[model samples]
Target chain A: MNLFQYVRPAEQKTAIAAVAAEPTARFLGGGTNLLDLMKRHIMQPEKLVDVTRLPLKGITQQGNIIRIGALTRNTEIAEDKTILQNLPLLAMAINAGASAQIRNMATTGGNLLQRTRCPYFYDTAMPCNKREPGTGCGALEGFNRMHAIFGFSDKCIAVNPSDMNVALRALDATVVVNGPKGERKIPIADFHRLPGDTPEKDTNLDKNELITAVTIPISPFSKNAYYLKVRDRNSYAFALVSVAAALNMDGNTIKEARLAMGGVAHKPWRLTDAETFLKSKTATEENFQQAAQIAFQGAKAFKHNQYKLKLGPNTIVQALSVASGLKSV
Target chain B: MNEQEPFCPNESRRSFLKKSTVITAVALTPAAAINAANNHWDEHIAAAIENVSLSVEINGTRHTMDIDPRTSLLDLLRENLHLTGTKKGCDYGQCGACTVHVNGERVLSCLTLAATTDGSKVTTIEGLANGDELHPMQAAFIKHDGFQCGYCTPGQIMSAVACIREGHASSRDQIREYMSGNICRCGAYPNIVDAIEEVQKGGQKV
Candidate 1:
């Protein structure tokens, strides 16, 4: 890594200004992704504004909403009593993603902003529009085994690698951020952006804007929530097709449902249509299969990831089956 | 820029005299320090220009070093202070060979910036034992043969200790799940889980 300026600002605004002052500067969180990116020569920041000193590490609940500070470590959030009790889907998803050591170091805010695991994006030698625009996407034609099955453009076939994000989208969480302009709340769905023509932009968050916290309204699906991840391995691997399925059940009928899938799109692929279809329907394997089919209506698969076309529905049905208590976990 | 705390350097096993003299020279006079650091003048100068003051208590000894802000805690242990027991398997978070306890929580040292650990307490594999006496987890690893080639042993031990402490070692499957971060390329996972289970079952403080 090249030599660069590093500043540890104590306050949130000071940290924001330090990053805003230098266009090439970036905010340093847990440094799990940023440091690795820098070492790989994929990202080169002239200055790093360290925000670890900022007092933004806590989980607070107000009435029905729970607010998690930006710097709260993944392990902290996963193991918190209230989170496991109320938002167990988030806990299950976070725990399912990485190992315990990584979860200990990774922060909640940093997890949301993690880049794609697409091999092309990590390999600078490859032509990746996400790395450098107009470079041409190597994954689009090259071995796209881990590429997207939805929300992909002709320019990029990468997928967001965060399992935490998939659960957050299902819970309808809101991301609170502070920038030079002011503070604003972005719903989790809007927080991450699809790699449209501009594959370089991963999120709707502007430059120098710091994520302060994430708030989630008390969920109704806590009793019947499940995060099912299918990966190359049973443990310590990214999901090939993961589902965060939650249901509000009235006996055997589904009062409501929130569903999202990971490793299939540039963002957490929220199955709004599937969720809409499952409402008032009986919670059964046949209904889940139908919902799963509806969720993948617009999903487009690549050459190597055609297995996802089959794996995707299986994962969705499995998640919904377990979450609805039609089948055991 | 503040009072440097010294937590009893009277019994340092790694020649605290020479290290403290070098630290004093570096903090007081750059000319003498540069001469002392002649081998790494390039990194020293660059890091000196944007020096971030970091004071960390490692294994009971306090060290305040000027580091390149990008210097990871793994690099700090292996390079700066010569405490190389903590292995750097992947140099990234993927492999947990750089596992260390930061304020009693196990974290990947390779992913942790030295500057970010300024006021924190760090414990590496080198610090697990009390002088010559091994920790309970270490003894259990020996009894159960938890490693082969021993490259990933240090990180596995650190993470194992943490797994038990975090109450994640309740079952064999849970131990494997929690310790998945520390990958043993030699495939000593079954024995590793046995060792952790023994330590947990023995009810020994790690």
Candidate 2:
């Protein structure tokens, strides 16, 4: 990593001002992703405003929403009694994403802002539009087993490899960001952007905005939610196809449902159509299969990811089945 | 302007004033001043001027040192403090060979910048023993043959201790899940899990 100036601002205002004043400066939270990117020379910030000590680490519950500070470590959130009880899906998704060591070092904001794990993007020598705009996507014609299957443009086919973000989208979380222009709350659905002409930008956040907290509204599906991540390995691997399924059941019928998928799109692909189709339907294998089919209506696969067309639906059905208490695996 | 003199006084004074003006501008912005000093000056001088002083307690020893802001906790331990017990397998956060405890939580040292860990208590494998007595996890590792080549033993023991302390070592599957970060190349996972289970069941203070 290149030698850079580090300033740990004790105040949030100071940290926001530092980032706003310097375009090349970045806020250092847990240093899990940023430092790794820096070591690979993928990102080279001239200055790092250390925001780790800026009073942004807490997990609180208000009347109908749970506010989680952005700097809260993944392990803390995953193990917090309130989060585990209130948002079990979030906890399960976080635990499934990384290992214990990484979970200890990775923060909530950093995890949401993590870069794609595409090999082409990490190579730095390869031609990746996500890494360098207008350079052309290497995965479009190269090895793309881990590329996206939905919401992918010809310019880029990378997927957001975050399990937590998938659950947050399903829970309808809101991201609170502090910037030079004061504060703004962005819905989790609109937080991450699809890789269109500009694959270089992964999020809807501005360069100067610093994420302070994420608030998740209380949902009735907390009792019937599951985060199923399928990977090549049993643990410590990014998901090949993951599903976040939550159902609000009235007796044996689904009253409401929220579904989102990861490792299949540039952002957390929310299955609004599938969610609508599952409502008022009996929680059964057939209904889940139909919903899964609806979820993959527009999914397009790449050269080496055709199996996702099959695996994605299978995983969704299994997740829905397990989440609705119809079956357990 | 005496061209033959090779040093025009007017041009020299003008360049000096321009350089001074730039320096004055840099000085006004401390962040820019630090970057300017790092880029335009000698690296050693830049490091000396830009490196932040960190007073950290590691392995029960309190030491004060100056380190580059970019220096990782792993590099600071191995390179600066010469604590090689904490190995650096990947230098990234993937491998858990550089695992250590900061405030009693097992974190990837390579992913932690030393400058960010100011005033925090750090504990490495070297600090796991009570002088002559080995930590319970270390002893259990030997009893259960938890490793082959032992390159990942220290990290495994450190994580095992934390896994038990964190209440994630209740079952074999739980131990395996929590200890997934520390990879053993020789496939000593079965024994590692056995060792962790024994340590957990023994009710010994880790």
Identify the candidate with maximal TM-score.
2
Worst 10 residues of 2 chain A by lDDT: A1-10
CA lDDT, candidate 1, residue A260: 94
DockQ list for all candidates: 0.32, 0.32
Runs with alpha carbons beyond 4 Å of true place in candidate 2? B1-41
Q: Scored by CA lDDT, what does every candidate get?
A: 0.86, 0.87
**Candidate 1 lDDT by residue in tens digits, B1-206:** 12232121122422343355545444523233334333364455434545566788999899987676778899999999999999989997888899999999998898888877877889999999988999999999999999999999999999999999999999988988998888899999899999999999999888
For candidate 1, the per-residue lDDT at B119 reads: 76
Clashing pairs in 2: none
Give the clash total for candidate 2: 0
lDDT of 1 at A23: 70
